[model samples]
Target: MTATRAIVVMGVSGSGKTSVADGLAAALGTAFIEGDSLHPAGNVEKMSRGVPLTDEDRWPWLDTIGQALAGSLDAGKSVVVSCSALKKIYRDRLRQSAGGALTFVFLKGSRDLLTARMAARHGHFMPASLLDSQLATLEDPSGEAGVVTVGIDAAVETIVARALDGLKTVG
Candidate 1:
């Protein structure tokens, strides 16, 4: 078996993090964790009400994701997780928790495209109203080590393929 790797599919809410991460996990034959599902109930409620989460509100959630990644890596298992790791600090936290063996696949897209995608979605806790907040908070990870930036303008399969190819360079 290939050595275990920890990967985070990160982007704004509408940037297809879930789909791409799911595909990536399947391709890698690893567990798929939806980071949003690990959020505290209060945080979900706040987002469901269209309220932007403060940094304080996000710390615990980020910690939870980090712990999940760390646990998988410690068990010698590859894992893919979906997270809107918009800020550099959040990504750094995840890296530290995962013992620095982490790579991120950043899904990039234009604002117009993201807004349209958010608008078309249904039954999601995050509202389109929070997209601006998320975009504002996003720190582009393009030049960061262990980071792969894949444009979200293509189909999910293409995006996943691009991410896999990019991972070859960083992983």
Candidate 2:
């Protein structure tokens, strides 16, 4: 098994965060956290109504995720968490909260691919309309500390395998 560490599966909506995160957790023999579940009820409601969350709307929820990441690490366990950490600042906040190093797996894909994926998705609160906003918000993580980028233009299994490989390589 890999060492106990937080692996944040980050990407825009429809970038296969859940599937990749789940695969990573299973591969790493660790726990998995769906970050959207940590959102406040109001946040969910707002997003469901097509309103994008502002920083104020996200702070408390981000704090929750940070705490969970820190707590899990303190307990000597690894976790794979899925979060749309679109901006560098958000990633910084999460990394600080983890209280240790975070290995972020950034799922990168084209706008067309993402749009198709989002359109095909069912039962997700985020609408396909939000993709452009998210894409605009994303600050490329190129050469950032403790981060690895993986292309989402492949099969889930291939993506997972590549991510695991990348993790090993980066570490």
Candidate 3:
């Protein structure tokens, strides 16, 4: 069985990445980082203005998340990260920078669910209007390396439990 050094919870906005990653980290008795917080001020500003981030805009943020993942592995602590890693390129870059030390748990759901979730949110820089762009940009993680795809809309406990189950399978 291969040991997992890090787990990345990925999905578009409002797919519950944060909640699931937090729960998974707690369950694994390790640290969890919110990938969004690592985003540069410029990226936040762009998203706040309803502008979708280009590949160039996201490189630094992705690298930052990857570094965090690598650091956790170096510390010998399991880690979980909440990130909207919507593209294969993004995931590949993250894995590369993580030094081949990460697993991905992708939360997938209907656009309607994500849109509703985005709309109900408050005090967020990402506007609901940007959801279409986000969805469009999203490339499902199917056939990607070291990835587990989990259905969205399940209870948080159920979601976390399934993630743990997946880890056992992978390990």
- Against the true structure, whose TM-score is highest? 1
Q: Could you give candidate 1's per-residue lDDT for residues 1-171 as a string of tens digits?
A: 187999999999999999999999999899999999999999999999999999999999999999999999999999999999999999999999999999999999999999999999999999999999999999999999999999999999999999999999886
lDDT of 3 by residue, 1-171 (tens): 235488899988888899999999888877889999999999999999989999999999999999998887887767889999999999989888888777899898899888888888789888988888988999999667688888877888998888788777552
Off by over 4 Å in 1: none
In candidate 3, how many Å is residue 87 off? Answer: 1.0
Q: What TM-score against the true fold does each predicted structure earn?
A: 0.98, 0.97, 0.94
Q: How far does residue 92 in candidate 1 sit from its true spot (Å)? A: 0.5
Cα lDDT, model 1, residue 164 = 92
- Tell me the lDDT of model 1 at 20: 100
Model 2 stretches astray by more than 4 angstroms: none
Error of 3 at 63 (Å): 0.8
Q: Which ten residues in a row have the lowest lDDT in candidate 1?
A: 1-10
What's the CA error at residue 141 for candidate 3, in Å?
A: 0.4
Top candidate, metric lDDT: 1
